[model samples]
Target: MPIRVKLDDMLHERRLTLSELSARVDITLANLSVLKTGKAKAIRFSTLEAICRELDCKPGDILDYSAED
Candidate 1:
């Protein structure tokens, strides 16, 4: 996957638990966990907005693009 998920890092930096983030973002823990673990195939912009707002971060903070070798 060229796109990497940085959710765990941001969460750790903010000292936030997955459950806390889920509640804050109004997303289910299971769904958020899938995203945090890089198992989610896609994310809606609305969901992204909620997450960014709650975490006070940009999409780049949670997602990154990398070239394949």
Candidate 2:
């Protein structure tokens, strides 16, 4: 995928664990782990909003495009 998820880095920078983020955003740990590992195929707008809200970050901070082969 050209789109890379930077969720792990964001979490580290914010000093938050996946479980903590899940609790704050009301998302399941499995789902958040999928996103953190870049294994998720899609993300709903509501999910994105919740993550951003809890992380105090923008969508771009969680996801970015990488044109590497």
Candidate 1 residue-wise lDDT at 69: 97
**Candidate 1 lDDT (Cα, 0 to 1):** 0.94
TM-score of 1: 0.95
TM-score of each: 0.95, 0.95
Kindly provide the TM-score of model 2 when superposed on the true structure, using C-alpha atoms.
0.95
- Candidate 2 ranges beyond 4 A from true positions: none
Best-performing candidate as measured by lDDT = 2
Cα lDDT of model 2 by residue, 1-69, tens digit: 999999999999999999999999999999999999999999999999999998899999999998988
Model 2 RMSD in Å is 0.7
lDDT on C-alpha atoms for all candidate structures? 0.94, 0.95
User: Which stretch of 10 consecutive residues in model 2 shows the poorest summed lDDT?
Assistant: 30-39
